[model samples]
Target: MIGGVTAVAANGPAVNVSSVNVTPTDPTVGETVTVEVTISNQEGSNSIVDVSSIMLRTTSEHYERVEDVGAIAPGGSLTIPITTSFDSAGEKNLLAHVSAASQSNGSRTSHLRAYYRPITIDVEAPEIDAGIAASTNNSGETTVTLTNYGNVELTDAEIRTAVDGTQRDQRSTFDITPNESESVTFDTTNYDSDAVTLTGAYTARGERHEVTRTVDLNRQVQGEIRLTSVEVTERGTAISVDGEAANIGGTDVDSVLVRIPDSETVSPASGAGEFFVGSVDASEFATFELSSSVSNGTDTLPIELTYLVDNERITTTQTIDLSTASPVSPESSQDRPAATAGGDGSAGSSGLPLIPLIVGLLVVVGGSGLLYRLWNRE
Candidate 1:
């Protein structure tokens, strides 16, 4: 009897890829990440499967690949790890693929492909934020501060300073970490400008950023000379004035001179025209004397002061009330003494009367002569 032959179908290897995971699911640009893909063999498979290749890829590009993976038993799973770095930042989809072959009769057959579920990865962009501030002190020293406010560290930081529009020779360069600050100081004593500008630049995440800050400089006079303790004394036809010059400003003054300018009512007194009080320091004083001849009907003494401040000449005028100095009247209470009553009940000057004293002198001389003649006759 001829029996009908029944053909048996062969069972191929089957693999199910699931659970696509990425270490550091939230990643920044240019940061490395690891992708783990779990590959499982179906329980109904007839033979052990050998994984040929495992690849981690996106929809448009492949990031990592590994070949020659070992065999996985039926109803068992194997995990494949791949490492890569993302060059850009944004939402990304990652898919993993596994190639497997069935091992039967000690031989491997054609590969079967399995794809893992795509995973969503959020890639963050690099953050860079910074600022700059500047300030100056009374001594003409300026300080600049650079602050990093973002997550990235700053590198190759440089600071440049300028007074008005003129750039300075001194430059500062350093590094600053995230959420930190750095400072630089410069001597701007020689620069007397009104404004100081600070420019700063730094590198973060392969990009350079620049910042600028401007500060107003307090332009104060280096030396301020003020007249103090002034006194006016009258000596015959000459008037002598003594005073102190106080320097109340920031620096010292040079070639300080006090003089009474020649005017209709006042003129310099001979050799004592100008008094020199040189080099008065800040918050210090120097004594000076000025002499002048004052005419009648003068009410104020116009005193002129000249000095050198920061190599520049400065002149100032001050006035002292002559009415308060000495009386202008001839019979002033301070100039003449009080009168007294004489023996004849008449008001006389301080001493005896001039004519009466002269007559008494003559009478005494005649008496002395008469006495001498009588002695000679005897």
Candidate 2:
């Protein structure tokens, strides 16, 4: 004791351990953590502390270290940061040790200062799988499936669809658990056998992931046929209908039969109301004729047509008016109506025979007048 003052020991290490900071103290498996070690020589009276090495040791399953840190001057501090990850879960211990040489009270000695920290790790991982369902077609209904394949739960799962490489529809589910799957449907009628894509998107553990699936779409064949330019004619009591039938669809039509269906005001002049026109190719036209005995005045004719497409008999009906046509008399004999030689021969005509009927009416009136005058004179 000098000057009657009791000697006081230095409160901190000559090379002081200032702080030990751990980043991401709460970690997940497969994630990184950072440990920062700060050391200082607080006393200028001591020589510069020669730091040989700095090592980071953890009680966790993995081990990592940092070495070859040369030295630190007196009254100066050094900070070292170490980065590492954990493979297992649970609590872990970390130690940062600095090996140094310094002069204390004029004597050279080796000193070690260590800092400690603890970490807790939680492990959670999420996986996703997506695909298009089998046999998805152009019937306007297509299915898409999304599966959660990992150990964690996912949220806000959405599935979107693309037809023929263009985005078309989307659907969503609120959440999905581990190893769980969900499905959604979309209308795909506007798409053909090109390509259909299904994309599944979701979030897990604050991170987002997505998966995609693609498949081919199969479409069905459709056919359309139409009849145009309908004309009706009459000869005596016989009636005939004429029109052009065309196949305007994607498929061919065969064994086509055209006819005027029988109604209360009309009956077939020959056998039945039907007449066959054979086959009509795609985008081609054929002429049809139907003969019947129809009463005068405005009459509705039900013209029914049928054909074979893919071994299916398809029938269609067309309605027409026969009021505009004039009936020709067989005995009154004007220019004769055109005769169509069917299995039963039938005829067609145009324009009325008005001149001969008017002449006959005049002659009858004049002969009546002459007879009347002679009887009066007698």
Candidate 3:
């Protein structure tokens, strides 16, 4: 008891902090860290409780600060938990400190700083994403977009696109930051497929990552026009013609022109021989008129048709034969060709007009025979 005049009683109401414990000791940036501090009062006097302030601080490079704690009783201890996080990477020093005073004595003593295990923080790595989209117009093009959707920047990124398993285009971009995007285009007119895929690869923090995406094809408005029917009227040396055109393709056509092209055998009789058919909707038909003159021996004529598809002009030519039509005299009562159209059943005539000539010959022969007989009898 002589030596026990005693070490703890000699100093009195002394306050000190126990070792600190940090949870999730291995933490990445933006993650939470929990700090637990234990404050102890070593005094034996029950009436003289120790009042103390406990705080947590870092030596230099780190983010760890807790609210000061107060009021600890003699022969008692208190433990407090606080949450914190670090914004940067690397090692950080954590320290806990406590300052104390007692009612039995007015002296305040500062306890030695207690060090905890160092914290090593790791940063987030770069992430990349890719997606594909396809669109077809008259020119037939498909565009693929590669995006960096992650929170970090990537370097030396390469992107490749394919349609129906066939490689179409490939490109590379450098230092693509988060939210940045790049595009690659392929000619889909001849691609002949509805599915498209995009693949991208990049290097980040000495690691390589790859991403892929697939999309269906989207086609824009398109139009297709075709000649449906043609009718030819033989008016003396000139011919009056009417034709029907149909929109057989995907979209509607705004304007269509139908005409008989000038040749050695045929020429525009009255107008330019070209007529506008107006708008033709999908699966709809429009009519056009043309007047042309033909030479005595000419039997073939070319018909030219023009229309628009996706703002592009398309021209088509068709040949029709008129020799099969029966010859019609202006003196006869006939107005149109007696034969049916040949090519595509649209409008050219076939076969000769022998009915009118045969009738006239019979009447002339009967009349002539009667006159000759009467004259002989007289």
Best by lDDT: 1
Evaluate all candidate structures by whole-model CA lDDT and list the values in order. Answer: 0.78, 0.67, 0.64
Model 1 lowest lDDT segment of ten: 1-10
- In candidate 3, the residue pairs with backbone N, CA or C atoms under 3 Å apart (3 or more residues apart, or in different chains) clash, namely 230-346, 230-347, 324-351, 326-352, 326-353
lDDT-superior candidate, 1 or 2: 1
Write candidate 2's Cα lDDT for 1-378 as tens digits. 001111112442466556667665455566667777676777563476656566666555335667766566777888888787777665565456566666566554555444333433333332344333534533447767777766556688898877667788789976887667788777777665558777788887677878787876554444556787777887856777778888876567899888877777778767657878788887788887778886766467778889887678899998877676666666655566654433334432433345565799999999999999999999
Model 1, 237-308: lDDT tens per residue?
567788899998887899998888998878898889898898999889999888899887777888888998
Per-model TM against the reference: 0.41, 0.38, 0.49
Residue 337 accuracy (lDDT) in model 3: 52
Instruction: Supply candidate 3's per-residue lDDT for 306.
Output: 90
Question: Which regions in candidate 3 have their CA more than 4 angstroms from the true location?
Answer: 1-129, 192-194, 233-238, 249-255, 281-283, 296-299, 307-313, 321-378
Per-residue lDDT over 1-378 for candidate 3, one digit per residue giving the tens place of the 0 to 100 score: 001111233354555564456665555455566767666766665533444444455565334444445566777777877678766665655555444456535433443233233323344432345433444555567666667776555678887777778888788866776668766666766656667777787875567887877766666547777776776667566777666888887788876888888887789765658888878888889887777888887767678889876677889887666654444567755666555444565444544345565799999999999999999999
TM-score of 1: 0.41
Model 3: lowest-lDDT 10 consecutive positions: 1-10
Alpha-carbon shift of residue 259 in model 2 (angstroms): 2.2
